[model samples]
Target: MKIDQLATRACAPPGLHWPAPAAAAAEPAARQAGAALARQPGQAAEQALQFNRDASLQQVALDYLGRLEERAVGVLQTLAARRSASAESALQGARAGLERTLEQRAAGLGEVLDGQLRAGPATRARVQFEVAGLASLRAVQAAGAETLLFSVGPQAGGPLAVVLDEHLGPARLLRRFNASLGQAGVQVRVEADSRLLFEIDEAAWPALREHLAIRGEGRLFAATGWQVPPLREQSLQAELRQAPAGPVLRALGEQVLERIRAAREYFQQQQSQLRQQLGGETRAAAEKRRVALDFVERLNDAKTTAAGAPSHFQLNARAASVNRAIARSALTRRSVLGLLA
Candidate 1:
């Protein structure tokens, strides 16, 4: 009999007709054997139904869990994509800001350079004259050499002199020559080795170089036995106060540009790192961004100084470059220390 039928008959009300226990016991052996056989199949059918129900429930639970896991992964991926986008946007903005700042600095530097070039007087020129010595002027004189003559400054009232004479001695000769040279605004100094050096004053340098026109006259110095020593020629020099040329200005600009580019790249890397560490908008992250923005704002403005000379501009550029390095180093130090702490 089916399990449901068996259950229904067992639970019937008392008024139902039924076989007596004595009649069942008195049944023939063949009938008893048939009843035992019928019970075995009914028990197996009930066991099979219970197993199918358990397997179905287990499969349903597995499917439900798999779907839940897939949904969770999808949500996490979406969140990560959003965080990455935000990071990219922030980096781009910072780069744009840095570029703007660099452009402004370059423009300002150019103007200062132009002003420096224009400040000089047309007549002003830079020059240097070097004078060195012979072993002994007395030796040349004792050998009966011809006197050497050289003049400094304009011909009209400039100092002119013959080479050292033996009777005067080096000391006396230097003293006599210095007296007149000093009066003419030219400086003369005797070295440890009795070599003499002459240099014109800055106030009179240009005119002296222009008209003095140092040239050999009959090789007078060579007429001294050992070929009287030759005077070194003077050449134009750039004064410290003079402005640099275009190439120099461009070189300076390149130096500053390189530094600014390095700083920009550094800040960009730092922004990327921050995004990786803190993907979501939180108070701590917001505060850190604010600090970074403050740094950017401070970097936007630069200080420029206008002085009377190009030397001052050089000094200013050096000072500004130093300040930039210090600022960047300080920021890097703070970040590293904060991480370690």
Candidate 2:
């Protein structure tokens, strides 16, 4: 058992004290000595009275000593409290002075750092973007840049976004952001939302599709938020295909998190509910890869409708707004991969 547990158990027993035989003997001896001293100068009855008086005096002295000890304790405590208060005041003054100095410095650099300092955990998932070719690109840094959305380069070179170069797989965004956020009370959670976007090179898109060997009928993709200038037109697209959470660890983690947050355990008493869900939910496996399947499929069909060289007006009239989303790249493959890592 642990020592504290043992101590607790020991406390359950009765606590008791008994004077040692020697101590009891000493008390009696003192009483006898008092009696003898009293007898020396008095009659027998008077000596007995004197003995009681002497014993009372001894008790008074002991009581007085106890009062002195109590007073000493009180004095010590008061002195300690005074010292503590003085130290606290000194510290407060020093802190206030430092704050004043910092305020002055901030005023000197007013409006320089107006950027909001908010950072939090983002929901994580892995994205596999095939390298169209090889070239130099910028990677993200913990203390430097927080995110890298997209980049551009020659058509022969691969993505201008950096990965650790040797690593690929589902990695939690939390691992990279632990020190980056740098606050104790600030909380973080990896959340999932409606959609994520990837911006890829238009020229590289055709090459990447072939390299990945995806043979989907038509996939939805998009690129968005164009400010900086680029070599190609302001657009990119991808052929989305069904992909699995690679490796046993990540697959298990995803399943575990879902199950923990599951509203209800459908097959709590029964067997294989989760397993069945993972494998396939009825005819869904046969259905389009996911819910987005229809949007992209319809959008792609709408894009190339009436395959002759058509007028701009006809193309515009036939185009679905949904296809615009698919064509526009919001999240680049490089950026997505970095978040996953």
Candidate 3:
């Protein structure tokens, strides 16, 4: 399902399921202000209770993610072959859980995102960037499609997500960047959805932030209260943020369109290269390549339901097919071993 729909499924509010005893607790919180001392004579015990409740919720959320992270990391570390898939799925679940918890906590403060934005339908693209890491030099192609990615780092403990390519809107980048920085303990005030100003409490390297801002556009979003590092102490941090489009970001969107058309052609070359690498003169590794390729195709076919729709049981069924494929692969391996014997 689409991320928004998935969140709704999980965090639909508790329906004011106030407990019989707790009902009285809400009664006096609003009136607690009226009881304020004419001569500084009273304490707002009710308001204090509310504050305590909110703090408890925050701790609960933190504890949940911490425990979940430990479990996911442990399972992923041990499950060698299937670990990547498990990790991807687990990452999505954890991030979604965090979003839902925050949504509930922030509802009173008007901080939650509208469940599913009623924007234009998604626009997509395919872009190529020249990536050079010494021996890793190559032109890498990536699909700039409308999908959400949860980015995390020390500064970005929370996930920020972008739904689509910037050609549709720069706001997407800003939102994702905001969430990412938000989780990092940065204070972000989006002047508007498109513009952001942030304050970082602490940073490992400050110059890199300035450098990125310059590339994005001068003061596209200002950083305040940051202590600049000396030239000698300054550091270069590689790949802090994923590739994003600038204000004048080339609408290589059309270029991306052209490249999507080139994909069938590109696929032929990729198929050949993969086959040759695996199906070397020494022995055929086509079996492994086949297993991996089938997975790649299935991933391409999955689609999410719209925002308000019920769960797409059909998609879940397709996901099960993936499990069946894995089982069949194991069975095939056993059969091959028997034949060899």
The model with the greatest TM-score is 1
Candidate 2 Cα outliers beyond 4 Å, as residue runs: 1-42, 84-341
Span of 10 residues, lowest total lDDT, candidate 3:
132-141
Task: Sort the candidates on lDDT, descending order.
Answer: 1, 3, 2
Q: What are the TM-scores, per candidate, against the unseen true structure? A: 0.25, 0.13, 0.18
lDDT of 3: 0.33
lDDT of each residue in 40-91, candidate 1, tens digit only: 3454345334433433333332333234334323323333344566654653
Best by lDDT: 1
Tell me the tens digit of each residue's lDDT in model 3 across 78-125: 333234766656544543443344234223321211111111111221
Candidate 2 lDDT over residue span 1-341, tens digit each: 49996687677746644334444445454456345433433342343343334333333333332343343233233333445666546534433332233233222221221001011111121122322111112112112222322223233243222212123222443333323221211112232531112323223443433432111111111133322321221111011011121233233323323432231222121113322432352234224223334533443343334232346664454334323322222222223223222
lDDT score, residue 264, model 3? 29
lDDT of 2: 0.30
Candidate 3 positional error at 253, Å? 33
